[model samples]
Target: MVSRSRTRPITGVLVSLTAAGLLAGCVPGTSGAGSSNSAGKDTVVTDPAAMGKVTLNVLDTFSGGTDNAWMTSVVNAFEKKYPNITINRTSMAWGDAMAALPLKLKSHNPPDIVPPNNGWQSMGTLVRGGLLLNLDNYADAYGWKKSFPQSILSEHQFSTDGKQMGTGSVFGTPVARASLIEVYYNRSLLKQIGAKVPTTYAEFDSALAKAKSAGITPITLGNADQNGVTQPLFSLTDAFGAQSKISDFIYSKGDTGIAQTGFPKAVSTFKQWSDKGYLTKDYAGLASADAAQSFVNGKGLFHFDYSGSLPLKAGQSKGFGSFVLPRDDGGKPVTTASAAANLSISSKTKHADAAAAFLNFAAGEQAAELAVEHGTMPLLHANVKATGGDPLFADDVAIAQSISTNGTAVPFLDWATPTLYQTINTTMQSMLAGKSTEKAVVTAAGKDATAYAKTLGN
Candidate 1:
């Protein structure tokens, strides 16, 4: 989630798997007659070393920051442990990876390991097309079901036919970090405005109003490229609605609508904040990274963003702290969150065993330790030690734990449809600019999701 300024926007163009010929053949270990390890019954590899000198071609989006360092550590650790598998990693920016992966999966030779963005465009398309191998067997073999939280694991699952998501077979495992959309507040600014850190929606609103009355920017937002608004907007939505309703709308489950969730109210709240001068005046033209930097430099009371976008390292920025946006009832926190882009295996890869081994290794204690050391949230959060000296990272881990255990974490709304990204982004910008209504945005999202659901026969 580090800002890669040059990355392209996601077009969300879903290509048909059969039309593109992406399913070249039966997935390894998935098809055969009467073999215990065949027909996908038992894929537990007792010894991956038996494969002998296999190399995994990997594509990932952890190209910068502590995330990249975590990736490097995992690969080196896996190589040292196995000593027979060589990992050839290709890392790119998030947007670049999202745009390139669909095309790459369609190639004759895709990477043995691929980073698939969650939702319909990449994960769904590849799963439906038979480009990615199901990881349920590997999960079982490695005890992943017991090690990883079901809340995190559920995001990577989809039906065999790919029409449904958030259920069915596991397709991938999160590599390094968990991402949560939360509020990063400037403690100094809050104190200066005579407002305390908020623990509920009412308190947060009071702080925002106090900051505005004190002539301080209550929030610093940058949506120039449409990437910055989602955190706050979705966090508010998560706050105002049940996670089940939000997830239903996001995954095209049942007849739930975006309007049925708190999305419309969240949008209206965002618009009200804009109208009240609680946000940066030039948010429409500012980039997300710049906005985060401005908050780190002490210009705003709060800056909402994903955990991975923290502009400064833990403890590097003085008088800065983060909190999951609280619910109105003063209950446990909830937010839009999931593991970072998950790593999936290509079904066409000849080295399925080795690739699956690498994934299992990445989800282990060693990898979790490395992830925490590099300031990223570990997938095995329950076992990993809290960061030694960095309060910021410790807070991050605590927030992630709190959400995972005590509250609900919903999926990002963009996952609702291939085109929902553009639809929401444009509509949000227009709403903030006073050119569109919240009802229009909600209605458009519902219609878009319903139309896409029909295509999937949902």
Candidate 2:
């Protein structure tokens, strides 16, 4: 995801550090629903009246930006209607939220709802540990399968031991659709240089060289957060190779592992750009500063990031334009996309029906409109119009539509394994430090991947 530098440092620390602090709390025990008579097991309450005066605890990482307001409104409305049901809200920095989630769920009391970022990374762990409720029966009964798009539905559903874990289980609901790795260019800069936008790898390289000749940083990449740094590399990898190859590397799906194919090529391309000075020298230490600011401030020629940054750029600067990252051969541009922020229910929640109703409303048309009004692109239905200050939002919507309709997009790599995201972030930081080789990074990644896969019994 892309955004201005306003994200608090505390949030970043929380996301990165919470994992270690919370892992110890995950022990098997009966939830709060258990009764005094049922000494060892949780009480099963199927009837709505049986679960009275419930308070649904919601934990989310949307501390800043439009999403924060949007979610607040939704929760407030849900509470107003169900007067007896209260929503206890807890907001944290994204990093902290991600880190603290697993530990919190393992505690004696866990939130009924969690808005995990688009991926299976943290959610996968919960599913594996049986912390999340299976929403399949509820989803089927409520006709959610018909209401949600296939891509969105597929993300929540997973298979374990050849049995589907979360897909039909209704464990989660998507909040928005996320776009990863689009190319944002400063139109004024391109016009000043009299350069045409590049549509192929060779042309892209030439464009970068031209920008450098004009004394402008060709690309604005902030790697201070490892995920920020890796996004551009992942985008470039998709541009240079086939989508299937990228997927194999990300998922570690084949017999030879992800390294034997285009994985090395992707690394080599990143190294080449770094060696040639296409990326800034201080990129490794750069945090998630506003990518649009770098380009709008004339510090860089182009910025690569999610569609979420569109409004920030339009509001903050003028003469900005964006495109789907061009393909290697210039045939078509492909991107990575997924259900943006999904809502999931805890397996231990007593008011399962009420919780499901709230999520259904959250994912429905009304909530989608709220997302569009807040400058977020909606994944459910494309008919809703954007209402933010960003004029370039239409272009972003078009690019997203093109990719969704004609291109091959996949989920983010970090989504596959529980620890792969942290490992990748650490490895990328090491590479940027000049202390790690591409081969070494890949090897370390493979070790981590193997260990994680074993947890899944793969």
Candidate 3:
């Protein structure tokens, strides 16, 4: 599948559903979901009314909480501007979306726009199955190549056989551009520990020591789902040297390995934090959401997570600050994992022109602003000032721009394989519980990394 910097406007309609709960829903109607207008796939039609009235069906994982509200807000404006098109949405919580999408793509009624998921199994599976459309036509038609940077667009491409990305077929346009990992700190907690946003590892370690001395949880981590540990691991890996190989390994490229690349510091950092009393006691038992909540609730000094984690405002999150974690050896900012949030059309979409038009509009400046309004940063290059209700939005935009300038954002470690997330989580769980050695964690993950290569037939 191809990757491009595409904008996303989506949400869960209901907040109650779990990822498992998402499985019971029927597949969305695929009956020519992208049904064509007479102008054909190559047609250029910008006016919604001129393209004729149509209802675009979207199935996505944004069904609950802020995601649902944020998406509704974006669509509200989009519909007002183009009175001819209506969006019929199917929502699932992120887990549900992740669980449900593989099956959804197999349907005769597959959605025109696939709900976005970054897993190799979910995205890579579809690309390999030939289920997603090759969006080169739309890319050319919309001048999307010029709209998004090549770095952002690279991951969306997949070889026809689905064995490669970064140079091949273009699949989807991405949006909600972001840094894969950022250290979000609770403002009050930082002040209590006498900490400033650390630009170097030494400063960060010093902050941790101070926070621990103050009897505050220096960091809060929830690993119940087995995925949370990877971010810190990623952050550690980013600071390690020759970090370009980290991305290379993630992309299944030339002789690169995660364990060899960044595993040592990742384990060392975790061990140091645990021994320093910097980690929340019994953190392995908590969920990522729970840990994030605790940090926001003032139980911790820092929460290492993404920009999209907890929404922060002047009154909320007890005052907040965020910064991209710096490497122990800084030269290029190491982005352990980041990608264009890919949004693609189905090959069977008959409404290619209309679908492409919607994508085109989503890729523009207005949606970029709308993204900021909803607490997600846009992937575009345009200047959209943060409204100041939340400063994190503005901070994230600067981070995203830094990523764009640097010309690379690596994939999350979990992208190495469907199993990698589980491995990292379980390994961290073992380490936190004092049941496994750090060397063992690295050894186990490296084995899986090799297995992932075999699975990819690379």
Which prediction has the highest TM-score against the true structure? 1
Q: Taking the tens digit of each residue's C-alpha lDDT, what string does model 1 give over 16-65?
A: 33345433322333331112112143645747678799889999887876
State each candidate's clash count: 0, 13, 28
Higher-scoring candidate on lDDT, 1 or 2: 1
Whole-model alpha-carbon lDDT for candidate 3: 0.64
Model 1 misplacement above 4 A: 1-9, 12-41, 46-51, 313-315, 404-407
List lDDT for all candidates, in order. Answer: 0.75, 0.62, 0.64
Best-to-worst ranking by TM-score: 1, 3, 2
Q: Report the C-alpha lDDT of model 2 over 19-137, residue by residue, as the tens digit.
A: 53322212355321111101112333334344568888888766876768877877776667667778788988766676676667666677888765543455554554556666766
Question: Per-residue error at 178 for model 2, in Å?
Answer: 2.8
Evaluated against the true structure, the overall lDDT of model 1 is 0.75
Query: Which scores better on TM-score, 1 or 2?
Result: 1
Q: What would the TM-score be for candidate 3 when compared with the true structure?
A: 0.83
lDDT of 3 at 390: 60
List the candidates ranked by lDDT, beginning with the highest: 1, 3, 2
